[model samples]
Target: MSDAQTQKVLDHIDADFDNSLQRLFALLRIKSISADPAFAGDCKAAADHLAGDIASLGFDARVRPTAGHPAVVAKSNGKGNGGGARPHVLFYGHYDVQPVDPLNLWHRPPFEPVVTDHADGRKIIVARGAEDDKGQLMTFIEACRAWKSATGSLPLDITFLIEGEEEVGSKNFAPFLAANKDELKADYALVCDTGMWDPNTPAITTSLRGLVYDEVRIKAARRDLHSGLFGGAARNPIRVLTYILGGLFDENGHITIPGFYDGVKDLPPDILAQWKKLNLTPETFLKPVGLSIPAGEKGRLLIEQVSSRPTCSINGIVGGYTGEGSKTVIPAEASAKISFRLVEGQDPAKIRKAFRDYVTARIPGDCKVEFGDHSMAPAIALPWDMKALSAAKKALTEEWGREAVLFGSGGSIPVVADFKKTLGLESLLVGFGLDDDNIHSPNEKYDLKSFHKGIRSWARILAELAALPR
Candidate 1:
């Protein structure tokens, strides 16, 4: 665990990186698109292949069945190096890539992995799941490989929990975790599905927003009524539905639900000051997405609005309509799908109840409202001073030659919360993905540097983590 020892492992990583790329390419070639039933065999193949590969590195690895795609669970105890005293860590990632729809947009076949030069002259590995997960996950696996080859064992006990259903909402993954809870115990988890701050700056995601999704239907009449006859007398469900949803946010963009923001709190002053230095602006973060304004709470910084604030969004709405042209009719029912992104300290159940209450309060007595619960998950917030977090920051800084940044992600990784719920484990979210990786899009690529140096970074991180006092 000394610096010289870490450097030796890093040197081994550098020397064997070409073989690492070849290994990643082999995994990418399996076409493990978990969402498409046509690729079910490929998903199994990817699981078998990855499990076999991990098992070769002195792990007790297997492809375990789930309700959906099978998951790979691999375990190692450093071959007696720990003697049960080393801190146990779990590493999580996914093997399944998004489907290659609109395949013509890709310059090359989506399944054909290749090393190519970007327009900016940087080398990239282009393939499905390149930067999204497969490539990023391999960085850690290769690091372990390097350490095993160099020192004949890893620095700490490790477990790998790679799944095939992440891109498909991980519906079966939580159940799998519950069933295998006793076998997957760990002090903490390391997830490799997020992005760095920028191409050159590493980052640790310390918080993730939770989610509540609901579908509501407003039924005003027993049957569709002709608007020509019911225009003034009968109630129009679409009109009623739109009116309620339109008022969900005030002019200043704060959600108008009662008690919605009751538990929300501002970031600490020190963290706020650091974020101010980040200077995230509309031109920098929004312009590329064809936007010029921050649309959350008016007074908060753009960074806070997007990454730290809770938000409500109307994902879709539908009512009576015409196939080819407008029909003069008052729809019997209108439905809307809504979701809320929740931050730490906010209870998803409470927020969902508040939203339902708000909607029900405005429902006319003549109209019947039916609610359909879709999904709900609580937010995740890691301690700012966790020992593993500090070790990861140091490891990344040493490998990247820049201070590692920490930030809150507006999005939710439900598995992170599931780990906490099922195994009493917190997760450290880290990765080498960049902003332009185009994951879930055509021509997805991982920076060659992200692959090579990412391996070295993990090698250093494992060493640093092992040296921490128990």
Candidate 2:
């Protein structure tokens, strides 16, 4: 475990970098778009392709059938996955990608994968699933292949669970895991769907805030009425709807729902102080979004505003009619899509209940309300003392030659929580994705360096994990 030994592994990764790109290009060409049914055959093709590729590395690899698209379940056992002196690691990624719609925006055919350079002097690989999953997933697979080629086997036990429905919320993955619990068993999980702290610095995601998405509709009169005729008598549902959501926050900007904070707590003061030194300012956090104000709880630091505080936002609203000119009519109904970003231990059901109560209390006797379903997910916050994290952190820092930031993300990855609750496992979220990678958008790309060094990163991580004291 000396620095010299780790550097040797990294050198192996750099030398075999072209093979890594070739493996990535092969996956990117498979067209595994899961949300669209027309690509079902392509999805299966992608899964089978991955299974075949991983099998060459001496894994018991296969494309397992799911109710939706197929999943690649590949594993190499007993290098200590069952908690022998060696550690077992579950590496998660998606082989599927979002639909490449508005394909005209792309400079070239999305499925015609290629390694290209960005306008800035940085290297990039462009394709439909380039950086989203295929490229990202291949990072680990290529790393394993390199390790196997160099040292004859991955330094540690590793299981890969790349699915075809992650862009669609991984509907079949949880059940698949439960059915194959023993085969998929691992001490912890590693997810590569997240991004780095910056283009240059590496990051280990320690927390992902959960989500509680809801759609609320407000109804007043039974039918549309003339605003001029019923201006005083009929209730304006749009007005009522706006008033209800507008009151979701107080003057200090905290969510006003009762019990929303029931289980919410502060990050340890030491961690808070460390985050403060990281300088997560409005300039750094909001400048990209064209805003500078911290819009959460008034007294908290900007980092707390995003990572720790639960928030309620109205995503969309539709009510009155006005295609061109004013219709002068009062719409019978108004609906708004409101979502709550929940923090660790914040119950989605409780937050929904509190929000409904607040809305019902605000409604006039003449007005009625209905709620619609969107989606909800609980937050995940890992213990700082997890030994696996330390082992991986050492690898990342060594690979990048810079201190890797252990940080919290404001977004939610519900499956991470599902993995812990349903299977009793903690997941380590790491990846080489950068913010500008344009994930979930047309022309998505992963940095060529990210794809190249990412393989190397995992190679080092595997070696470090194998060296951990279990």
Scored by lDDT, the top model is 1
List candidate 2 segments past 4 Å from native. Answer: 1-5, 78-85
For each candidate in turn, the TM-score is: 0.97, 0.96
Error of 1 at 190 (Å): 0.6
TM-score of candidate 2 versus the correct structure, residues matched by position: 0.96
Model 1: what TM-score? 0.97
* Residue pairs of candidate 2 with colliding backbone atoms: none
Model 1, span 58-164: residue lDDT tens: 99888999999999999896332223788788999999989988899999999999999999999999999999899999999999999999999999899999999
Give the alpha carbon lDDT tens digit for every residue of 246-297 in model 2: 8888999977787878988888887788788888888877988899898888
